[model samples]
Each structure stands twice: as structure tokens, then as C-alpha cells.
Target: MMMNHCGLLTERKEAVPLKSIEVQLEVKDHVATVVSTLNYENKEDKPIEAVFVFPLPGDAAVCHFSAQIGQKHIVAEVKDKQQAKEEYDHALSSGQQAFLLEGSEEISDIFSLKVGSLPPGESASIGLEYVTELAVQADDGLRFCLPAVLNPRYQPQGSESPSVQVTSVPASLVPYSLSFSVQVSSPHAISKVESSCSLEPLQYLNTDQTQATVKLAAGHKFDRDIELLIYYKDAHQPTAVVEAGQASAKPGSLMGDPVVMVSLYPEFPQSVMSSHTSCGEFVFLIDRSGSMGCRMNQKRPQETRISSARDTLLLLLKSLPMGCYFNIYSFGSTFEHIFPKSMEYNEMTMEEALRKVEKMKDDLGGTDILQPLQHIYSQPCIPSHPRQLFVFTDGEVGNTKEVIDLVKKNSGSHRCFSFGIGEGASSALINGIAKEGGGHAQFITGTDRMQPKVMQSLKFALQPSVEDISVSWDLPKGVSATILSPPITTLFQGQRSLIYAQLTGKSSETTEGSVTVKFSFEGHPSKNQLHFSLKPAEDSGLTVHRLAARTVICSLELEWKPNGQQNEEIKKKVVELSVQSGVSSFFTAFIAINKDSPESVQGPLRCRIIPTPLYRAYIDSQVRQCSGKIYCPPSGPLIVL
Candidate 1:
């Protein structure tokens, strides 16, 4: 009997916790290596698996070969443990077709598998090495999916069929599917459609404008370009989506370019779950550690980690709902409450909080985040309302597992979100805590334009629409979550770092689903939910992130120096997250030194620097003007640490 059991993901202001991820990217000799290390300690008794999956950007041709299980090897304990590996080896020798599906294409023969035992109280690694030839790039982005089935008739002891689901980007119109409600530029607008097989110019905005149509033949695809041609009396250049005079007759292939030209960020629901009320208690745990002094703002810009956090936090407070209770908690070696915890929202407290933030001094000490978090959780004056704790820091503590568990236990009645500031901040740890705490994680170095990321997070707090939205999967016999987590799992936006697990069994039904969410506000409880049912096949847009990561990885294979054409191309791809995956092309910040104690620096100091534009100011300030080869001052060597 296939018993269908589901874990309820409620939309409680104080529901389950979520954790985020920290992505580290390294580039050497035109090859970008992305390391996404998320540390999750299973509280359950039995052994389990963790899976991570993401979309693949660029064409399938870009990926050369792939190797799985580099550092840690994973094995399944069936009726016979050794027999599982033997059977897997047999499958590979038999030439069974294995490929990753992306949009409508397939990336074949990309992975080499290995099997090793993983006992309880231990960890295993599922490493993926795929060589790509495409010039793809991306930020801390990757598509992660957790499949259900792992072994045949050898189900995990405490595991359930896992379901995986992801929200597609808006404005993304997939052919042959139900199209979204679209408003064209004009009702009578002329439409030009082109594909690999044919080009059809529909009747000039005909009377039957109710629907637009374009047809493509079987086995034929095209890089389609849609344009609107306008005719005006006065002289005006016809604005076209592509280069002028270039017709949509034969659109060339989008090869050697970044596949993730566009990206779709998830829009979290705001309203609270039904049967719940917004409690006004909030604690802003600001990390004023010494690392916050690092300056990223160059020349025209003069900014540091502290200043950036201050500016963004002020904006967030400004958007706070009137009469909302809040407090500030700053941490270094010791915890200090900037303001007394209060339930009443008033100008006095707000002003006091703002002043405390401005006057907060930098303390050079090891980061012990749990101290301040525990303080907030232990407060006697705390109300029963939904509580929020925001942590901002630029470093990782020694004890990650202990701190995460503490946050999870204390967060039983509150939501915790983390903001990583400066280079030293542990993006993964911050994101993980937020995930386990059922909140979101964000990273703000000097590079990111503060408004967008900040506003996005605030919008979530102002009006939370859904609560406890958990994702799970159920795979057919043999397949299981590969990249990370085991079969049955839970996902939270901020707390959970995104990961994709690789599957090594026969491909069949790959089902993903999410629990309905509830929200309560204005003394009214509202109900809402979204679900998806996808089969494991070539057409399912499941492997978008995997493809994207492979694309960037492939792009890095070519030899490219700093400020060179290849370098610029990589930067462009990194910004476009949809077609790029992993940290293959994310630029790095390095320090260079040789023969110290030079009299003076000279020439255009050509050195490898971080990707962000904000760092240019520091480079210019230190490096003196000169021609040809330049030298670094003895004390002023180029450094990113």
C-alpha cells in the first residue's frame, strides 16, 4: 500500500525555521570553481541523505565531462550493501542512457559516479565535476532539487518519498503550455516571429487579435525574437529589440554567450497565516565586529561595512508599520542591548534605537552570535506575538552546529534572518541559521546595490503571504536525492541554502509538491497554496540550475586575464543568473606582492582584483600613476584579506 503522508507547513508567524547558503567562487586559469558547503546536522536518529540541484545554463555542447563524488562517496545499504555498488557498476557497463534535462534539451554523459559507505553520525560528499566549453557565469546561484526514491525496494528506514518544487521566473513563457495573461505593447502591433524551422509574420494586428500564434515544426527550435514595428509621421528611428536592419529571418544560435541573461527571484508571500496575529516583538542583532571597517567604496564613493549596514537598516526601520514594537541588540565578544525590549512602538524608542546604531563602536572580537540571540529569547518582557531576530555579521563562529541548533530551538516562537556584511562574513552560516529559523538570508558587501536586496527583504516582513511552505519529492524505484539531503525533507526560503542532489537510478515519475499556506492579519485568517506535479522526462524544466552552473564552468575553461575580453564576458554572464549556475565565473579578490620596499609604484597597476565596481576606489587610491610595470610599496601590498 502506498501510504500518502504529508508534513504540514503552516504559515505561523512562529512556525518552522529556514536556513540559507553561502557560495564561494574561485577562478584560476580561466576555470571557475564554485564551492557550496552547507553543514546540516540531522536531529533524527537514523542515517539520511542531503541533495542539492540547480538549473544548467547555456547549450548542452558546452559541458565536456562530469565526475561525481570527489571528496565524499555515497553508498546505499540495500539487502546487500556491496551488491548496490556492483549493480550500479553493471548499469554503467550496460550503456544505459543517462542525461540531465534542461528546458527542452538534454546534457548527456556529464557525470562519473562512485559509491562508499556512510554510517550514522557521519557525513559523505556528493561532488560533481562537469567540464563546460560555453562562456557562462553567475553569482551565488544554482538550481537545487531533492528527489524521492533512492534504491529499489530498499527504502530508507526513516525516509518518506521526497517532493521537490521551485517557482519559475515570471515573464517566462514556455511554448505548448498554458500562456500567462500578457498585455502586448499595442493591440494593433505588428508581430514578427522567427524560429529554427520557419519565420511567420502574423497578419498586421488583425481583427482577431484575441490571441497571437506562432508555429514550429517537430525537432526544430529557434532563438526567437519578438519585436513591434511602429510607424509615425515624423522622422524617428524604428526601435527594434536587436540591431537595426537585422531581420528575424534567421536568428543565429545563442552560443558562446551566457545562458542566464535573465533571472527570476522568488516573491515571498507577506500576509500571516490564519489563526495567528502579528506580535510586535523584534530584535535587531547588529554585528559591529572589527571586520566591518573594511572599505569597499572607491574614489567618488567612500563606504565601509558598518556604513552600508547602517544605511540599509535605517531604510528598513522607516518602512516599519506604525505601533510595531522592536529593539536593537548589538554583539561582539559580549552581547549588549541597544534598547530595552518594549511592546509599544513610539518615536522615543525609534529615535533611541537609531542613535544607538550610529554611536555603536567597532569591537575586534570573535563572533559568538548565539549569546545575543539567547538574550533576546530569554527576555522576560517578551510578548507572545510573532518575534523576529535579524543578525548582521561578517564572520563565522567556531561552533556552527551548536549555534544553529540553539537558534532553531529558541526560534520555536520567532523567525530569524541573517545579513552577511563584508568579505569575512560566512554567507553559508548566516543563510543556514536563517533557514533553520524559518527566515531568509541576504549578503551585502560593498558591491551589491543596497536598495533592491534590502527592499525585497523588507517587503517580506511587511506583508508575509504564506507560512510553513515545505517542499518534498517522490521518485520512482532506484532514484534518490543526489546532491545533498535525503528523500523526505523540509525547505525554508532564508534558512535553507539551495542544493541539488544527483540521481543514479532508472528515471521515472519525479513528483514535487508543497503544503498550502495560511496567513492572519487584521483579525482575519486567509488561506492560499500552490502545487506542481512534474514527471522525470526531457521536457520538464527541472535541471535549469544544473545547466546554468555547467555553462559558467565551461566558460571558465578558456584562458582569460584580468580586464581582457574573456574576463569582461565572464562578468556579463555572472550578472545573468538564469543561464549561469554555481560560482564558476564570480570574480575573486586577491593580493599581490613581490620584492617589497619598492621606492614608488608605477604604471597602470594591472593586478587581479575583486569583481565589484566599488573596489576600484581603493585600487586607485593606493596605486600611484605610472607606465609599464609597476611596483607595490613595502607596507602597501595588494591584499584582499
Candidate 2:
């Protein structure tokens, strides 16, 4: 069988259409830079346009995109999304070659790229570069993940926004090859690099132990997500990075200002840490939708998602602080509760919940989470013990913004700690709710230990978070700092708090810049100070400006909820911010058109599925005919909250 346009095997036993993928990643301190090249060829007899959807880390700042046909490389320029769309349509309808890269308006972590009109047997190479901050795990390891799987998200009936859809293809039918490597460097010495997947031994580049490199092993399949855990000699040291601004930008604008990112790991008072873990009304909400029956990973078939979820629930149930009130709720189309109200944590009640959890299956029908959340909010809050909500789910909701709004509204009464069970978890949902409601978010995937993040969230829930967090900067006269992000809100023990601010105007040559973050912890005031010279750091391709813009866009979107009176005004503000930053937002996308082709063309746009980055569960091809049937492929126990 011949290859199709998009890549998936369409006909009976067809060849995989995808060609090869090459990735290069470089990490400096806590920031990572990634460049990815994907080669695609059209083997069909007719010319066709290719549409491929892929996954990017939630916090990534995509800065560059280009398409190479033969020896010529065409770079893309950022523009207004609607305007870019018009240009792309006009060029394409007139038979011109156009490439468009658009971040999902609905989901932040998903991106769709369109390569226009490649004649039969023609090939094009696509290149992209992005920068993101590496998350420091609770175990003091810098975690970097290259997503490889994009699970099909399940939308509840009557969802306002149309859900983004994905098609699953068998791994055996996949026809592409992947090569990945990373170069790492930092001021502190690196102890070791770890991963669940195989990797080449570390290769040191410099005489000092600060720089090293690693690569994926030979004959490795592009199946699961590529995860690397980096351990540094000094894990918790506070560090600040000063990024240079764009030379072509206006001197006073955001792109022109040097941005500074500060990373800190707060040390809490031992007396307060012990005191805060004793009392709280803890609510655990679990998703029992049909999709929850899917396993956590493709490699391990016997570990169903529900079983792992049950295990996590058991562990959390046993760890609840004594004297604390707790309740268990599972929801699909409807919701089920173990007790009418939150019951105190005790041996009898805990045992009852555990037994119920053991017998629980993916019995609930649909992923309608709003009702359960509303019910929880309507219930009376128990006195003295603050309410802490824990949500576990493989996030697949279509009404993401609506859910986030609800959580934000009720945030005053409770803190939300969310866990995304497996790959394709909605970053917008998990991260948005946690940011709005004051709490933390954790994700458990294949080969991942849910204990570290789960225990960390419990620890944070028991302790009161740092309050009234504020950042202030001192610079030379005439030099001002515009904070790109909103103020700091939640600060958990052992977690890093990062801040980005644009340093505008000019500081005197002799003048030094400093920033201080102040907050009240354990009823005592605390402050962190960082001082640095005005000189710019090494050029990182304006990575900091893009990241700053991403931060601002997220902050603005979180604060800008569309309402009757301010709908158009808010949209206008977001568009303005997106265009100015040269960053694709919910309101903006990147599009480019090739004017070289002048002849009009006629052909169907062919789309074959390209697997998302991250290892995933095997897909079930047979569609279930009855509502009572649960079709689960062998996978790890995955349960989303």
C-alpha cells in the first residue's frame, strides 16, 4: 500500500506517511531551548495540503518557524490571526504555497500547522524553536518532558465551545523515525541525569563539570513521551537570569526592555510547617468518565487507569491529617458521594471510602464535571477548618473556560489542588484552576510516581500559603520596571516562585538593579532580594521577551473573563497585547504564504493523524454500540481529578 498525504495509514495495511523527526534541545540553568525539525513527503498521485496537530508544553514560548523546500528556507512572520488567515486563504485558493502555524484558540498546549499544496512525491521540511522553563521536581530534579501522545479529549454534551478532536493510530502502523538530544549547562555541577527511557551516557563538553550532553539511545522508538530528570549539585540555590531585549524594537516598548527572571525555593519555618497540617476540610473529586477506563501508558497493558486512581485515593485517604473533615465524590454525567457531607477523617470512615474505591469502575457515563463542582460549592463550609479541594482526572473537558471561571469565583472559600492523570491532560484546565483558586497542580503519567506530587500537594494544603506576595524593583533614575505578570499569589513550601519583569528605559552605567519579593509567612514578614549589574546576559535569541509575553498573555487571559458589558473591550485588549508581543495567543496566530506559485489548483485537503509527542495508551478501534459497555485498552491505572 502507498503512503497518504497526512501520515496515518488510511487504507488496509497502508504504509505510514510521516517521514522523520529530529530534535535538539539545550538547557542553560533552568531555561530550555528547543529546535524541532520534521520532514514530510506527499506520495499520493494528486497534490494535497497537509494538516498536522502536535503538542507543546503548556508554558512553552514558541519563537521561530520556517519551511524548507529543497535548498530554499522560508521564515514565517507573526501577524494578527484574522489578517493572517485572510492572506493564507487568498494565497491558497489562488494556488500558492502557504504555511500557517496557529496555537489553538481553545487549548493552549495544542498547535496546528498547515503546509499548503505539495505536488505528488514532493517533500518539505518544517522547523520550529521554542523556549520554556524547566520544572524543578519536589525531589530536587529539573524535569523536562517531550510530549509524544495526544489523547482524544472527551467533551460533555451541549458544551459551548467545539472540542478539539484527535484520531488514534496504532503504534505498529506508525511510519516515522525520531532522534532527540540535549545539551545541558549550569553554574553548579550536575550530579547525574535520569530518565525512564534509555539514553546515551553523559558527554562532558568543558573541562569544568558545568556542561554536558546526552542523547536518545540507538534504535529507540518514538512512542512514549521523552522525559529527562536533571539533578544539580546545588538544587535550591536562588538564581536570576537577565535577558537581553530586541535591538529592532522600540526603546520603550516591552520587547526593548531587558527582562529578568528570578527563581527561588522558599524555606518555611519548621514550627509553622508542623502546625498547618492538622486541620482542614479536604474534598476529593474523581472523574469516572468512560475515558478514565483507559490505561496510563501503552507499554504496560494490565495497569488500568481506574486501578492506579484507586491506589492514589487509598494513599491520600490514609495520609489525611487527623481531625480533618474529608469527603469522596466521583462524577461522570452525574456525581456520586460517599457521604452526604464531609466526614471527619477516621479509621472507620477511611476504610469505608477505601472499600468503595476498590469496587469502583468506570461506571459513570460522561465527563460532566460542572454539576459536581457546583454542588460542592453550594454546600456549607465547615467552621475553623479551611476547605481544600483535590481534583483527579484525565482532563478532557470542552468547557474549560467556564470551569475555570467557576473555580475562580469560589476560590475565596477553598484552595484547589488538581492532578492530571495521563498524557493529553488539558494544561489550560489544570493550570488555570490552580492559578485562579490558590493551589498547586500535579500530573501523573506513565512511569511517573504520583506519590511525590500528591504528597507535596497534601503538604501544601495542610500549611497556610504565603500571603500578600508583592515584588518591588529598585533601578537607576529614569529607568523603570513594568511588571509583565500579575502579582504573586500562592507560595508553597519547597516550590519555586518565579517572577518576570521588563526593565524599561536606561540605567546609569554605574547603577545596579535589584528586586525584592516580600510576603507574610507564618504571620512573620519575609523578603527575598536579588541584585545584578545592568549588563545584558548572553544573547538567547530574545527567548526572555517571548516568555515574558507568554506570561503576560496568560495573566491577562486569566483576568479577562468575557462579560456582557466588557466583551468587545476585553477582546480588543487581548489582540493588542498579542500583536505587540509577537506571540500567538488565543486571539493571534502565525501565518505565511508562498507567492511563487501563481496557477489555480483544485484538490481535496488530506489530513492523516500524526501522533502527539508523549507515550500513550493503545487506541480501541471498535466503537462501542451500547452505553453499558466499557471499552478499555490495556493501560495504567489513570484517574483524573
- TM-scores for all candidates? 0.41, 0.91
Which runs of model 2 end up more than 4 angstroms from their true locations? 1-17, 163-165, 274-277, 446-448, 562-564, 598-641
TM-score of model 2 relative to the true fold?
A: 0.91
Candidate 1 local lDDT, 596-640, one digit each (tens):
211222222111111111121111111111101111111111112
The superposed Cα distance between candidate 2 and the true structure at residue 635, in angstroms, equals 23
Q: Which ten residues in a row have the lowest lDDT in candidate 2?
A: 632-641
Clashes of each: 87, 26
- Over 294-317, each residue of candidate 2 has an lDDT whose tens digit, in order, gives 767656767766677777777888
The candidate that wins on lDDT is 2
Which segments of model 1 are wrong by more than 4 Å? Answer: 1-279, 297-301, 464-641
